[model samples]
Target: MPEFAEEAEVTADAKRAVRVAVLARRRASTADQRATAAARVQAELVALVRRLRPRLVAAYVPVGTEPGGPDLPGVLAGALPAGARLLLPVLRDDLDLDWGAWTGPENLVAAGRGMREPAGPRLGMTAVAGAELVVVPAVAVDRRGLRLGRGGGSYDRALVRVPADTLTVVPLHDGELVDRLPAAPHDRAVRAVVTPTDGLRTLNGKPGVVPHTSAGRTGGQ
Candidate 1:
C-alpha cells in the first residue's frame, strides 16, 4: 500500500475535531444533570407531539449521554391519539437505518449499536418518508439549522427520503445548540431544535447548502 491520505475535504478534520469536542462535553455531564435534563426533554417532546399531532412520527433511542433518554418513545406513545404510531430506528450493519413500531418498554431489545430498539416489524428504510415528524439525535447543532451528527453518516442517507415539507427535529442539551459549526455542502441541516431549557424553536435563514427539493422543509422543522 502506498499512502492512505485523508479524504479530499477541508471540513473532514474540522468536523471530526468538532465531533470529538462535543461528545466529550456530553460525556462529562453528571448523572444528576442528565436526569434533570431527561425529564425536561420528555416534557418538551410531549408538548411537541401534542402540537404536531402526527399520525406517524419517527424518533430514536438515546445512547450514552445523548438526549431523549430511554422513555421518549413510550412517553410519546401515551401522548399520541388512538391509532397513531411512533417509529424507532433499527441500526443496520452497514449503518443505514430501518424502522420499527415502538409498542412499549417491554418490547425494547438491545442492538449491536448499544441501543434498545423496538422488537417489532421491520419497516423499509424509506418508511421515514411517510412520517409527518422526525426527531433525530445530533452531536451538536447551530443557530442556522446546521446539524453535526455522529460520524456514522446513517441519517444523511435516510434523510433524503423525507418529504420536502416534513418537519425534522433535533433535541440538544441547551448549549449544544450553537451559532455555527464546521459544515460542507453535503451536510444536511435540521429545521428545529428542542433544548431542555429553551424547549423548541425554529431556525432562521435557509437550510444548509443543498438543493431545495432535497432538503426537507423547516417550516417549524
Candidate 2:
C-alpha cells in the first residue's frame, strides 16, 4: 500500500470517530442545556457581526445536533448593517455550495441530507468571494484552525474562494475546541473560533479584538 494511502485511510477513520463522538455528546444533552448553550452562542454571534460590520457574511443553518440551531440566520440578520446581506449555503448536487440570501427561517426549505436551505435566488458559488466574514459549521476546530466537518467537502471547496485575512470563524461547542485535528492539504485555517463558554478566540493566540464586545477571549491551545 502506498504510504499516503495508508495515512489517508487513518485520517478518514479518525474523522468519522470524531464526528460520532460529537453527535453522541450533543444528543445526550438535555433540552435545557442545549437551549442555554444556544442562547449564549447566539449572543456571541451577534456580537461578532456588530463588531466587524462586514458588508457580506457567509453563514450556515445548523443541522440536527449541531450547536447553533436552525434560527441562526435570524440572529445573523439581526446584527447586520442596514443594507448588509447574509448568505446561506445552497447545496449543489455535486456537493459544492451555491449562495442565497437569508430571508428568514420561514423562507427555508427542506434540502437533502436533513439540511435546510434558503429559498431565495441562487447566487452562484462566486458569491462567497464577496463575504468579508465567513462562519463555517464544523464538528470541531483545533488550535491551528483545522476544522473537522461532517464528512462533506462543501466548506473545503468554499474556503478556496475566501480571501486570506477574511476573518473566517468556526462556531463549536466549548469542548469541541481542541489542540489539533487531522488536516488535509485542502483544509482551510480559520482566523477565529466561538464557543458557548469561551466566546471568541483568535487561533493565532493573540487577544482577538472585537469592538463593542467584551465577550472575546483567547482560549487554550
Candidate 3:
C-alpha cells in the first residue's frame, strides 16, 4: 500500500505539471482560440450537470480572466434546473467560504479576489456539512482521485467538514484528468469526477456509481 501511494503521488505531480503547461499555452494563444475552447468546455460542463442533476451542489465562481472555459455562472445557468437552487462559495475575510444560494446571475455580487458570489443569506458550516453534492474546482486532477488545488487549502478545509456520504466531484477539462496526483494524508479524495468529455464516474479511491436524479434539486439529491 505504501509503495502504491508513493507511485500515485509521483504520477499525480507529473500530471499536474503537464496540465499547467497545457493551460499556460492555451492562455497564451490567440483570443479566438481561447474563446472557442471556452465555449466547448462550457457546453461540456452543462451537459454533465444536466445529466447528474445533483441536489445541493456547492460550486465556485471564477476569478480573473484566465480563459480556461466558461465561468461557473454560465455552467450554473445552463445546467441547473429552473427551480434548482445553486450554491456558490462566498470567500470570507478569514479565507473560508460561506455557502449561499444563487437565484440568478443578478443575485451575485463581487466578493473576495473579485469572484462573484450569491448575495443570499450566509449558510453556516452546518449547511455546508449537509450538502448532497459538492462540485470542486481544481488546477488539475488525476484518475486516482488526487486533485491539485490553488494551494489555498480552503477547499480542502471545507471538504473535510462535509458529510462523508456527500458526493464530492471535481470538474475539469478533458486533458486535465490524468493517471495520478500527489496525495497528502490530509488531502481528501472526491467520490467522482466530471470532465468535458466524461459526464461522471466514480473515482479510484471510491466505489459504485453516484446516483443521478433531479429529485434532490434543492439540497440533498
Candidate 4:
C-alpha cells in the first residue's frame, strides 16, 4: 500500500479502538451516573450560552448513553436569549447533517440511528456556518481538540461549513477527555470541550470555570 493509504488505515484502526473503549464505558454507566453527567453538562452549556449570547446556536439531542442526556435540546432552548434560535441537526441519507429550528423536545420526531430530530423544514448543510456556537457529539476528544466521532463523518462534513471564528465544542463523559487520539488530514479540530466533571476546557487556553446553574433544571423535567 502507498504511504498515504497506510496512514489512513492506521488512523482508522486507532479511531475504531478508541470508539469501542469509550462506548463500552458509557454503556457501563448507571442511570444515576448518566443523569448526574447530564446535569453537569447542562450547567456548563448554560453558562456558555449566557456568556456568549450567540444569536444562533447549533446543538444535537443526546441519544442513548451520549453525554448530555435526552433532554439536552430543551436545556439549550431554555438557556438561549430571547429571540435567539437553537438549531438541531437533521441527518440526511448520506450522513450529512442539515439544520432545523428546535421548537422544543415535544416537537422532536424519531429519526434514523435511534436519534430524535426536530420536525421542521430543512435549512441545508451550510446552515451551520451561521451559528456562532456549534456543539457536536463525540465518542471522545483529545487534549488537542480532535474529536473521535461514531464513524459516520456527519459532523466532520457539517463542520467544514463553520466559519474559522466560530466556537465549536464537544460534550463528553468525564473520562472521555484523553491525552490524544488519531487525527486524519480531513478531521477538524474543535476549539473547546465540556465534560461532566471538568466543566469547560479550551484546548489552546486555560480551563474555564463555569458556575453551576439552577437553570439547568428548567427543561430537565
Return the top candidate by TM-score: 2
Candidate 2: C-alpha RMSD to true structure equals: 1.7
Better of 1 and 3 by TM-score: 1
What TM-score does structure 4 among the candidates reach?
Answer: 0.92
For residue 20, model 3's alpha carbon misses the true position, in angstroms, by 5.6
How close is each model in CA RMSD to the real structure?
5.6, 1.7, 6.2, 4.4
- Give RMSD (Å) of candidate 3 vs. truth: 6.2
**Which residue pairs show collisions in model 2?**
none
lDDT of 2 at 156: 91
Which residue runs does candidate 2 get wrong by more than 4 Å? 206-212, 216-221
lDDT of each: 0.80, 0.84, 0.65, 0.84
Task: Report the CA-based lDDT of candidate 3 relative to the real structure.
Answer: 0.65
Ranking by TM-score: 2, 4, 1, 3
Which candidate wins on lDDT? 4
Q: lDDT by residue for model 3 over 1-221, one digit each (tens)?
A: 69978787776676567657856764566767656655654554555568766565677775543333436665665577666666778887787777888677778788766578889899875567766567787767777777777656678788888887787777665566667666666777777765534545567745455654332212111
Model 4 regions more than 4 Å off? 205-221
Model 2 Cα lDDT, one tens digit per residue, 1-221 = 99999999999998899889988898898888877887778788887788788889999998776887668888889999999999999999999999999998889998977779999899999999989889898988898888998888988999999997687888788799888888878888887778888877777564443343545553434
RMSD of 4: 4.4
lDDT of 1 by residue, 1-221 (tens): 32333442557788899889888898899988988988887777777677667899999888789887877788878888789999999989999999999888899899975878889899989999999888988999888778888878888888888876778888888688887888766677787787777766677564342222211222332
Query: lDDT by residue for model 4 over 1-221, one digit each (tens)?
Result: 99999999999998999899889999999999999989889888888798778899999999999988899888887988999999999989999999899998778999998878999999988998999889999998887778999999998899889986688888888888888899998888887888776667777443442323343421110
Pairs with backbone N, CA or C atoms under 3 Å apart (clashes), candidate 1: 164-217, 192-221
**TM-score against truth, every candidate:** 0.87, 0.94, 0.72, 0.92
Judged by whole-model lDDT over C-alpha atoms, candidate 2 comes out at 0.84
